[model samples]
Target chain A: MITTSALQVRFGDTTALHPLDLDLPGERIYGLLGRNGAGKTTLLSVLAGFRKPSAGAVLFDGAPVFENVRSTSRICLIRDDGMVGDGTDNLRDVLDMAAMLRPAFDSGYAAELLDRFGLTRKQRLGALSRGQRSAFAIVVGLASRAPLTMFDEAHLGMDAANRQLFHDELLRDYLAHPRTFVLSTHLIEEQSPLFEQVLILHEGRLLLQSDLDELRERGVSVTGPAQVVDDFVYGLKVLSERTLGPTKQVTVFGGLDDERRALAGRYALELGPVAVQDLFIHLTGGVP
Target chain B: MRRFPIARFLLSTHLPFLVMVLAGSYLLVAVILGVAVLVSGPASVSAVDVAGQVLHWLAVGYGYGAPALLATVVVHGRTRREFVAQHPVYQLVAAVVLAALITGVYAAEAALYSAAGWTQAMQPDRPFAAGDYPMIFLANVSMLSIALVTGSFAGVAVYRRDGAGALALVPAAGLLVYGGAVHGFFSLPFAQQGLPMAVTLPAVAAGWVLLWACAREVPLGNRVPA
Candidate 1:
């Protein structure tokens, strides 16, 4: 398990991550969802031990992660913007280095991943297209086989087809190996299917964390006559609502009890699940 | 088969450049020696001149290149989010290996010069004599080690600090190297006026300490080099 206590990160006078405690268990895929500047990358960087926290402790399996070689060696943080060094190294060199340093690194697996990604080993990382670089990074991250693997906005320049390819490979490899994976991304709807749990960050603070199944169950939408919907949703947390003449559809932010379902049926109201994306936007006020 | 072998990785990553510098410096010095030998006979190209010139060129090149090499490692390590502090030893190991390789080459060249019956030019204020091969090699190693370590320190200094900060510290570092060189501190094993190992070794240790201190301060974020 990885946990932080009052973990705060500050860059100059600006606090990138406010003090907050967090716990991340093993053998699960965690979707870290946040808008731009919501501190997703900063939080991941701290967890990777890349930067020291300004005010708290980050521990991995009961030991501090910062500067602890044994722990860090077991963790791999892959960022789409860049990885390891200046992107002057050839893909072959990068893989060779990873093969050397990473304990569980599978060279054969890396080779296969490169082929699957349509990336040649001889291509220099600097010369590769943006999408190719992202694929290359994913190849490294997956093949590293580190116990804790985190990818920070790693789909930046990928086309839709490539993005889906990555998601499939990630899930396939993840299920085969069963290691901890944290993916920070803006493509919430596309990636939400793979998440066992979701952590939502808003303005440098953790807004919510819940099981994916549980959170999906929480966002219940009720649609019926405008007067009936208003009466049903009254005194409840209404996340969002849309009105079209006499018809009204309201998305509320909590699960309904059997009694509430009976009441909805009695009023001829329709019930449906609100997509996680809409809930995210409603919670973070991202759309507004 | 070894996991990482960081020191080996450091060495291999840099071997090509080191070899290039060694070959380039050797060719330049060899040409100068060849010209002198052709014009004034082999007797004109003394053992001291050959050894001293080789040391000068090789040391200067390695010294200048050491920081660039270290910056590459340090920055890459940072980007990987690796614990750079624990790995500074890789740079130290690289420096020692570099000193040994260059010194070994210098020794071979000196032996060839000696066999050719070249006169001793007695440059670098250190006069060479029969059976002083060990002392000459030791002196060269010390000089190269000092150069590499100090260069590493300068690199870390520039990496951790901004333009004004790095510039402000350069003069002091320049003075220290100049003062040590002029006073025969660096030519320790061969010169009559040389400082003892007791002092010189500690000086080298101080350089390592400074390098480590500066290395620990290198932020693990992308900072464009100015």
Candidate 2:
């Protein structure tokens, strides 16, 4: 288990991540959704034990993660931004270093991934295309085989086919060796199915945290008479409403039990599933 | 296979340049010994004085070269971060080994210098002995340790704030500060007799402690994912 309590991260005058508590359990892939500066990276860094939290502690297996060699050694964070260095001559050199250093590194898997991506091992990583660099990062990340793995914005540079390949590989690896995988991405709908739980961070605070399926079922859209929709939505969180002609589609992220279903049925109302992405857009005040 | 052999990693980082230190130390001893004999005017500089001068030149090299070398290990960006996470203790071990290698290289030069000719023979009373050789080795090691450790400290400190360009200043700054500080106490006529070890000893001990602290204190921002 990985957990943070009342964690705050600040850089000079800019508040990157405010005091927030989060718990991430094992054996699942988690999707973290956020905007450009929504503190996703800060949260990831603190979890990886690469940065010190200003106020709180991150615990792995009930032990503080910061500088805990055992915990940190089991955590692998592959940053999607410009974290790779430039001066190297070729991929072979970097791979050689990896072979020497990363204890659990899989050379065969690395080579296979390189071949699958059509990357020449002789080519210097610095000279590779942006897509290839992300691929290389993926290879290293997966091969590291740490107990906890986090990939931040790793989808941006990947093309449709490459992203699909990554997801397939990620699932395959996870099933083969069950571990915790947390990924942050802006492209939600395409990747939502992979997530066991979805977390959305807005600005510096966590706006939502729920299982993917639970969040999908959290709200229902009902269409009927305005009075009926209003009556049905009573005591529920009515997220939004729209009326065209005599039909009404009032969406609310509240439960619809047997009584509510009977009421909707009596009013000849139709209930529809709320898409996670659309609901997220509504929650974050993004027009959809 | 070895579970991240930090010693081997350190060797890989510093070994290539250590060859340079060996060659440089030998040539340095020859040049300084010859110059001391020629310039102190045939009248008096002793073998001990020539050895001290040669050791000082080696210290100069450490001050100038060690920072540049250390900067390479001090984490510039992605590659460095990976290097640090994988090879965690390599730089600290490299600093110590580099200091030791430099001292050994200089000590070997002292043997060559003795065979070629002592700048000033110990005369009718004191002759160089097997025990004295170890003292000479210890003194040279202390000097090199002082230079390299101090260089490592300044290198890591300034490198993180900026990049390679910032570290470029460390070599020049370290040499000046250390060079001046070493020659400071010797200016007093009463302490001139006790100056050589006095200058190198505290500086070496202090620099070792400082670099060790630096290895622990080095921080690369927001690297681990939260």
Candidate 3:
């Protein structure tokens, strides 16, 4: 288990992460969703021991993580820049170093992933394209087999096909290995399916943490006549609305109770599920 | 002492590069000295004297390379404590190897000068006699090791404190000044009084201690900008 008590991170005058308390139980995939400058990267850096907290404690399996070799050995965090190797170093050298340092590193698995990603061992890290670099980072993250692995915006430049491959490989590996995986990404809709739980961050504070289905259930899209729709959702939290001729559709933030559902039924209103992406947008502060 | 894997890894990676650079430097010095002999009818200074500059610069380069290696090892799950502990071992071994190679260059130069019937004279301020190979090795080891450690201290200072790190050059210069002064002391008649070791050893020890203090708690930033 990973736990933080009043964990805070500061950069000069800016408080990147406010005092936060969180408990992340092991062996599950967690999707960390946050807007730009929402402190997702800061949180991950602290978790990975890359940055020391300004205040508070971060413990993994009841042990302090910062500068602790035993705890760090079980954790791996891959940032957007693929911090695995220096630019001048060859890809093979990076893998060799990983093999030496990372106890659970699987060289054969790494080699297989390298081939699948169309990356060669002889290529210098600097020479790889942005997309290829992301691919390479994914390869390392997977092959390290760390008990806790986190990737922060690690798939930013990957193409659609490659992203799909990454997702497929991640799911396949998680089933076989069953370790904790925290992925911080902007591709919410495409990646949400892989998340068993979701953590939403807004303005350096955690907005919410819930199961994927439960979070999605909070949003409901109601469609009916324009006058009737407004009357039905008048006192409720309305996320967004769209109109087409005489018909109106409004997305509401809260789940409708049985009483409210009966009322909607009497008014001939049709209620449907809202996409997770739409809920994220509305919950994070509707429209930019 | 327990086996330090990180230190061993550093030595394995860096030593080959040092050897390659040393070979190239020796070849370059040999070519220059051969040309000087052909043109001026046997130069007074030995090839090792001209080639010695490479060891100093290489020591500085070795020290400057610390930040990159620090990043690599830290990201690979090694602690700063592990790195700082093993790093001096790496530096010591490298310095000793380099010093021995340089001493060999002196021996080879002596033989070549004797074979060609050329008198091999050294600079007046040099700590050792022209034919004293052991003192030559000891002096080079001290100078080169100090240079390397100073370079490492400055490198980490800059790494942790970006723009303000430039101020480290002040202390770096101080360390080098002491390193040079100790060599001059070695040439003095009172060298056996242990004064040079007293002054120089503390400065070198202080450099290593300062490097550990600065690096142990430094927050690692992304080496490649996002």
Candidate 4:
């Protein structure tokens, strides 16, 4: 488990993270959703002992994490740029260094990942394309097998097929070796299926944390005739709306009570589930 | 708990490459000097006379290598403290190894000069006289050791503070000057051949302390996408 008590981070005059408290239980897959500059990277950097919190304490299983070898050695945070090796180094050199420093690093698994990603050990890190570099970062992150592994925008340059391969590999590996996995990404709908719980951040603050299903249930989409859809969503928390010819679809927060459900049934309006992406857009101040 | 794991890892990974480069550089310099001697008549200076150039190259190498190595090791789950503690061991070993190689080049050059009936003249400012291999090794080791530590300090300073961190080079220059003065590179009034350890040891120690201060709490910056 990881716990933060009044954790804060400030850079010059700008506060990156406010004094916030959180308790994150271990051995679960968590999706950290945030808009750009929402403090997601700062939080993960502190958690991984990459940086010190400006104030308060971050503890891993009741032990402080910053500069604590016992704690840091068990944590791995892979940022977008990989941070695995120098440009001059070859892929094999990086893997060797990782194997030497990280006790849990699985060399065989790393080799398999290299082959799966169509990367040769002899290729220099600087020679790989941006997408290949991201894939290589994923391979290192997964092969490290650290108890607490986090990836902050680590799939930025990957193509759709590579992203799918990464997600599949992540799920398969998690099943084989259960551990704490925190992924911070902008690909909400595609990645939400793997998240057991979701933590949403808005403006340097954690806006919400809940089970993924429960969070998804907080909003409903209504579709019918334009007039009826507007009337049905009247006085409700309307997040967003779209119209096409004579039909309209309006998404609103809060569950529909029985009377509203009956009203929707009587009006022949169709109700559907809202996507996590929609809720994220709405909760994060609606379309930039 | 592992003993100097960072040091061992760094040495094992980088030393072989460094040695190869050093050998290649030595061979290239020897060829150039030999050609010069053949074309211009008996050469006054031996190839090892210019071995001091290695000091600058080593400093540059450490300046660029330290931060990258630190990031790689820290991201791999090693603490900054472990890196700070173990890196000096690698630096010291590298300095010793490089000094020994330079001294060997001196021996090789002495033999070549003898065979060719050329004078193996050395610069007047150097700490060692011609044919004095022991003093040559000791003096080179002291200067190279200081250069390595100072380079690391400057590297970490730049890494932590970006543009403004270049100010560290001022102090780094001061340290290097002191190393040279004591090692007889600069003809200082107080420079004595056998008394260099008095200042050389302290300068190296001070460089290491500065390096630790700059690196201990340094935050790793996020790398921009390529």
Chain A TM-score, each candidate: 0.88, 0.83, 0.90, 0.94
Q: What are the per-residue Cα lDDT tens digits for candidate 1 across A1-288?
A: 789999998878899999979999999999999888999988987787767788899999888877666677678888757455346678888887777666688889989989988889888877888788788888888887888989988877888988898899899998899999999988888999999999999889999999998888978989999999999999988888899999999999888999999999999999998778878987898465
Leading candidate by TM-score: 4
TM-score attained by model 1: 0.77
lDDT tens digits by residue: candidate 2, A127-181 = 7777777887787778767788888887657799989999999999999989999
Q: Mind giving the per-residue lDDT tens digits that candidate 4 earns over A1-288?
A: 899999999998899999878888998999999999999999999999999999999999899998988899899999988758898899999999888888899999999999998899999999899999999989999999998999998998899989999999999999999999999999999999999999998777989999998987999999999999998899999888899999999989889999999999999999998888889998888985
Each prediction's number of clashing residue pairs: 0, 9, 0, 0
| Model 2 backbone overlap count | 9
- DockQ for candidate 2, C-alpha atoms: 0.08
Per-residue lDDT over A86-129 for candidate 3, one digit per residue giving the tens place of the 0 to 100 score: 78889998898788777888899999999998899999998888
Question: Which scores higher on TM-score, 1 or 2?
Answer: 1
Clashes of 4: 0
Candidate 2 ranges with C-alpha deviation above 4 Å: A82-86, A219-274, B1-5, B13-147, B159-176, B179-201, B208-219, B222-226
Candidate 1: docking tier: incorrect
Q: Can you tell me which runs of candidate 1 are displaced by over 4 Å?
A: A220-272, B1-4, B28-97, B100-136, B161-192, B195-200, B223-226
Q: Least accurate stretch of 10 residues (summed lDDT) in model 1 chain B?
A: B74-83
Q: Write the per-residue lDDT of candidate 4 for residues B31-130, one digit (tens) a residue.
A: 8886887798887876677666556556656655698888888888888999899888898888889889989988988998899898888877777788
Which of the two candidates, 3 or 4, achieves a greater lDDT against the reference? 4
Chain B TM-score, model 4, reads: 0.92
